[model samples]
Target: MSATICAFILTFSTLCGSRVVSGVLSAPTNVSLTSYNMNLVLRWGPPEGATQDLVYTTEYKTSVTNYNVGCVDIITLECDFTSLSVSMHPPIIEYGTYTGRVRAQLGSASSAWVESEQIILDRDTIIGSPRVSLLSNGAAIYVSIVDPVFVISTLRNTYAFATYSITYWNGSQKEKARHINNTQQNHVILKDLEPWTEYCVQVQINVDRNPNPGQLSETVCESTTSVEEAPWVPLMVTIFFVALAVTLVAVTVVYRKSISHFLCPKDALPQHFKENLLKPPNSTIYLDSHPPVEKWHEVQIIADTRTVEEEGPSGGSKDCLQRTA
Candidate 1:
C-alpha cells in the first residue's frame, strides 16, 4: 500500500513539472546579421503569439570567444554590435568572424536562444562611397577627398593602406574618360586639362588586401578657370573708371554757374525801358493862316502923230523930242 502511494505521488509531481516546462515563452524567429559601411547589426522577429510586453536579450560572440551579453531586457527588435561593449571580451576586430543570438523573456520564464548566421567583418562588410570635391586652378583642377563615415571606426583606421581610384571625363564626352588609379594622396591635382571646360570626377576606395573596391561617389563636375589675363589689365580698367568719375565731378563743381546760366537765360532790358521805346512821341506843331494886302502903281502914256505935212527939215527929231517931253 505504501509503494502504491509513493508511485502515485511521483506521477503527480512529474505531470506538474511537465506542465510548468511547457508553459515557458517561445523563442525568437528569423534571426539575421547585416553589415553596411562597416557597421554590423543583428535583427530578429518576435516569437509566435508574442505580445508587446515581451522583453528580449541579445548576445554576440566571436569564433574563438565565449558568448558575451550585448543587450539586456530590451524591448527593441534589433541590436547594433558595431559599438557594443563587453567586459569579458575585447572590441570587435574588422577581420574576425562574429555570431549573434537572441531570446525572448516574460517575467521569470525565458525562451530558447535563436542563433544568426556567421559573418566575416571585413569581407562581408559593404564599403560606402567616398566624397569628392573639385576646385579650379587656372587650367588644372585640385581634387579633394573625404573618406566615408563608419559606425565605430573610421575607414582609414580600418584600412590603413587603402588608396583612391579616380575617374574623370569631359562633361560632353563621357566615352573619353581618364583614370588615375592607386593614388595615396588625399589632395591631388589633375594637370594639363582644358581651360574653361567642364569636367566630371568620381572617386572610390581601394584596399590592398580586399579584392573589391568601394562604391564610386556621386559624380562631381567643375570647370577649370578661364585663360589667365595680364595682371595689369584689371588695374588699368579700375584706374580709368575712377579717374573718369573724379574728372566729371570736378567739372560739375567748377562750371556750375555757367552751365545754369546757359540753361536758363534772363531778359536783357528792364520793363520800363521796353515800355518807353514802344510809346509814341508827345510834341505837336500846327500851321498858321495869313491875309494878303492890295498895292497899286501909276504909269504915263504919250502918243505922237507923224507930221509929214507939218514938219519940214529938222522937224523929225524936234517934233519927236518935244512931243515925248
Candidate 2:
C-alpha cells in the first residue's frame, strides 16, 4: 500500500513539475518575411504571453552559388539585413531559392527552431514601385518619391538599397537620365531646364546597382514660365517705385521756400529808435527886441565904394547890409 501511494505521489509531482517547465518556454510562431527596395527583413511573433524579455536569433541560407549561411542575434521582433553580406548570386540550383529560420531564447531556456518556405529572387521578385509626385519649383521640377504605401508583409521583408533615376525629355530626340545616389531620399530637384518648353519626367529604380532597371513610373508633363513672362512682375514693380520717388522729390523742390519759412520765421523790424524835438515859443521875443549888448555885437552897414560912385546914371543909391564880427 505504501509503495502504491509513493508511486502515485511521485507521478503527480513529476506531472506538476513538467507543467511548470513548459510554462516557462515555448516556440515562436507566425514567422514571416518581407523584402522591399532590395532590403531583406525577417519577423516573427512570440508564443503567447512572451514580452520584450524574449530574444530571437535568425538564420538564412541560399541555394545558389555558394549556399550562404549566416545568423544574427536580434532583440526586437523584426531584424533587418539590408546590409547582410552573403553570396547573392540567386538560384540555389533552383531559381534563386532562399530560406530563413528563427528561434527564441531566454536565460537557459529556448524555443524550438521554426523554418520558413523557399523563396525566389529575380526580376519578377515582386518589388513594389515607388510612388512619385511632381512640383514646379521656379525653373526646376521638384520630384518627390515615396515607398509603396501598401505592400504585403512577406515581400516587404526583402529589399535592397536603391538609387532613384530621374529621366527627362524636353520634346527633343535625346532623352537624358540622371541618377541620384543618396539612399531613399524622398526629394530631388531637376535643374537646368528650358523655360516655356514642354518637359516629360519619369522616375525608376536601380536596385543594388543592377544593370537592368526596374519598372518606370508614369510620365509627368509640365512647362516652365516663359522668359518674357519672367521679368514682367519685377519690371512693373520697379517702375511704380521709381515714379513714386520722383514725384516725392519734385514736390519737395517746388515748395522749398515755403518749407524753409515755415521751419524758421522772420520778425517785422530789425531795430527801434527814439526822437528829440524843441518846441517854438508863442511870441518871438528875439525877433521884436534888439539884441542884448552883452550877448550881441553889431557890425556897421557898409556899401561898396565903386558901386556908390557908379550909381549916378540910375540916380538910385546902392546900399549893402553887412555884419562884421
- Taken over the whole model, the C-alpha lDDT of each candidate is 0.82, 0.60
Clashes of 1: 0
C-alpha lDDT of candidate 2 relative to the true structure: 0.60
Candidate 1: which stretches are off by over 4 Å? Answer: 1-26, 86-89, 151-153, 228-325
Q: What is the TM-score of each predicted model, taking all chains together?
A: 0.57, 0.36
Per-residue alpha-carbon lDDT of model 1 for 1-325, expressed as tens digits?
Answer: 9999888876755654422335767788899987877777889999766777789998988899988888889999999876666454468777788999999988888888999999988777878899899877778888999998877578778888889999999999989999999988999989898988999999989886566678999999999876644545766999999999999999989998887888997748988998998776664422223444569889888888766666646656566666777
Where's the lowest-lDDT run of ten residues in candidate 2?
316-325
Report clashes for each candidate as comma-separated counts. 0, 18
RMSD of 2: 22.7
Model 2 ranges with Cα > 4 A deviation: 1-24, 64-71, 85-95, 123-325
Report how far residue 106 has shifted in candidate 2, in Å.
Answer: 1.2
lDDT of 2 at 94: 14
Summarize candidate 2's per-residue lDDT along 23-46 as a digit string, tens digits. Answer: 445667887655544455567887
